[model samples]
Target chain A: MKTLLITLTIALASLSALAQGVKVGDKAPDFNLKNVDGKMVALSDYKDAKGAVVIFTCNHCPYAQAYEQRIIDLHKTYAAKGYPVIAINPNDPAVQPQDSYELMQQRAKDKGYSFAYLFDEGQLVYPKYGATKTPHVYLIQKRGADFMVEYIGTIDDNYKDAAAVKEKYLADAIDALIKGDKPTLVNTKAIGCSIKVKK
Target chain B: MKRFVIYMLLVAAVAASCTRGERPTGELAVPIVDYSGLEPYLNKSNDTTYIVNFWATWCTPCVEELPYLEKLSREYSNGPVKVLLVNLDFPKYYDSRLLPFLKEHDITAQVIMLDDSDTNTWINKISPEWQGSIPATVIYRGTKRQFFERAFTYEELVEIVEEF
Candidate 1:
């Protein structure tokens, strides 16, 4: 009975760990996802960089589409500042055909995307990051050899009109990190389309 | 006799036009509310079970699972189960997108548009577990409440409602 109880406890602990994804201050897991350029991209690839602004987004979601230009602008403005945008589409093509890898490549090319628009093929990465929706931002800062999640949530306060946005949550966090000061507002929420995963 | 028949047809056409004019244009007058206005619907001290679903017109899974929610409402039309659809479509799309979709689908349940921009503050109030994803649902009755951050089929929805 004692042996059985110990085994059961271990099993339960592992199960919960697998279920729960990375939270703020947690060491963000590295992934080798395929980029739109037909090359494998990994977090370690940006070893010399200060941090990365990881966004889990897709082509089909209107919310994601609305933030496309803003995401591009974020990369353009911050890439040289040591915090670049790493976009990964975590949707399953079987569930949402529009988010297929072929279309991601097409979208990147059409938009003249300077950053790597990666495909989290096999739907493996987003769940690990606890990304429940598209356009979910995970601002991970480089802490020695590990990338620690500093901020998580929406790109800004308003998802409707960019011009009218009052609070730039992701950008503000990046700016704070760059200035060597901790971000005052670390987390935020926004209405977004749920990430597509094949059942 | 031919002239008399023509007169009767003209009378019937005029009557049809009048009835059409009397009927409401498929546009439903849904209340657009902020988080504060929506809070009361989330918490009602009544005996009825409120199955409130947060969805948008653009969300594919949310759209797919809507029929099941509608069916649940129909099944318990006179019962204690009440289905409330909380639409999260952007305010601008309310007229151009949301209203047309609701009208086209003939959604019979009570629907209210959530126009609150401050989601970070209100999302936790709805449920701390909610990651601000659509197709989320909250089933509550008086003080007893449960939140689900997932889509449901008709049978699954019925099973959960039964448990409540």
Candidate 2:
């Protein structure tokens, strides 16, 4: 009986590691990445809210910086409606000093960002989400027994010039989920700086 | 009481570790992903056409152009044409970041992590007329190598591959 318990414990540990990251059908990886305010936030903590929008973002990267105001606008528009936006910075600070935790805190404060700007320590959370871009967006939902990814892609249709945005991909997803409808687009072709995952 | 104590300890440990947040995340400690081994092909090789492309992690145009090269590599599966995708991404970024990006893109070409930091040594080795901008493609056939610095649509990629 003791041997069986030991084997079960080991098996459970490995399973947990493998399943710790997010996938299409799997429950989104619950995390405690620190926000810009030095506060810790978890995906589970946002559970009672309608849904969550986690964006892998950074302080630098022209593409990300370009979308900064829109991201803030998104938080203002969605946080009150349940699908609050939670931004995660994945850039390594050793390579890009601009992305350091302190800078992240400073940038968040400067930008007046109302959302959770969390950090993915050692970049341990990026691969699970398969996040590749600075502005990679993920829409998460919980219907019955599990949490699942609702959408992933660019913040919108325009990047070179924000004034040219024709389709608001993120806004549409949040609006759909809020109205009790399945998001029309789940996966989109992304364009931005490739996420710089740290070791 | 004992079980509750164990559970509390587990949660505390997890919370402590998870709260550390993102460490400096640009480049990471990666296996030396050097392209020196493939230098011969670029320097003294006699392949009819050598298609060399420069790419990096932060460039969107580079990613957009990759699949075209991948498709070309597959279509010319029975040919002698060589497509070498030289990633200019720093080594640290290669291990921690580029691999995941490649995996996401479904890239299937002869993708190589070119360890060329000193731009002086390599910038001239590839071509004197070349500027180190991404989405730049060079097609070499025997003594000839043609370079293009723009995204290739499907038809354009096929034409370039055929010409090479």
Candidate 3:
């Protein structure tokens, strides 16, 4: 019976590893990544902010490109409100040369991105957040000592058209947290370009 | 003389219809579909092994692997396997972009357009492992099924499908 119990525990542990990344209600992992402006940025840097909008986006993805203006608008709308957008390029530059750090700076400059576009140099942070695709978003609310993952998923209901979007999942989640209430919907999904990783 | 004119008109109509039968270069008839329409194909049980690959034109890696997928589709034509190329391109751009891109690429495999908007609902339902990203694939023969969420080379794709 003891041996059987040990085997079961091992199996469960491996299963959790296979599941990958933090689930709902799990504390968000903190990371220090180089921003486009050549400064290292981390979640803890926004200590006074109510929440953070961490989006795994890249320079090459058309879906990410489509939502670029919307993401910029999100930052312009919410930055002063204390929910700053933190864009990260989680794709491997080896796999996708367009997403290289030098190109990221150029893109940010050309687009006039108000937010800090960070480079996940070794591609470590995204897997911890369970981000499988470019433009995957995670809305985190700062609690006493840890950042609580309030919402995980897409920026809005529509990726094809920003004008026709009825449901703003990311904005709604942030709004709820600012009002000191839990978001009604904590998760959503959209079709996005899978993160390019080297074979 | 009037009867002869009528006969000539009929012949011209028949000739036009025959020439029109030829598609615009490499264009294939790709139907736009929702989950209800696609669910039947995925769940239907049969001896024929169905290799359904979910992809889009904008997805770089997916486009990179297309030639390999097409080659495999051609190779397995004689076997009990059918490659269904399910494109998840945005519905609005079907005519302007997706169809033209299909024609340009000369995609010979049977292509179907997936027009579902609520990806969160269907991605998980397709396979719990899917996090709504492309290009993913589902291969099935009868009740046995396998889901892969990674890119494949020509050799790798053939090996996986052959085992199925």
- Candidate of highest DockQ: 1
Off by over 4 Å in 1: A1-19, B1-28
Order of all candidates by lDDT, from best down to worst?
1, 3, 2
- DockQ, computed on Cα atoms, for candidate 3: 0.54
Query: CA shift at B123, candidate 3, in angstroms?
Result: 1.9
| Model 1, span B45-119: residue lDDT tens | 988999999999989999999999999999997778999999998887877888789989989999999988878
Whole-structure CA lDDT of model 1: 0.91
Better by TM-score, candidate 2 or 1: 1
TM-score, each model? 0.88, 0.54, 0.84
Residue pairs with colliding backbones in model 1 are: none
**Which of the predicted structures, 1 or 3, would earn the higher TM-score when compared with the native?**
1
Candidate 2: residue A147 Cα off by (Å)? 3.0
Tens digits of lDDT, candidate 2, A1-199:
9999999999999788565545555567767888877788988777677778889889877668878999898888888888788899987887677889999999999989889999887887887876755787888886654457888766776554568777777799888888888778665543356555432
Tell me the lDDT of model 2 at B131. 33
List per-candidate RMSD values in Å.
6.0, 21.6, 6.3
Sort by DockQ, top down from the best: 1, 3, 2
Name the weakest run of 10 consecutive residues (lDDT summed) in model 3 chain A. A15-24
Worst 10 residues of 2 chain B by lDDT: B26-35
Model 2 per-residue lDDT tens digits across residues B64-140: 67887887777776677667787766555654678788788777776777663334335446665443335567777
Instruction: List native contact recovery per candidate, as a fraction of 1.
Output: 0.76, 0.02, 0.67
Model 3 / residue A52 / CA error / Å: 0.4
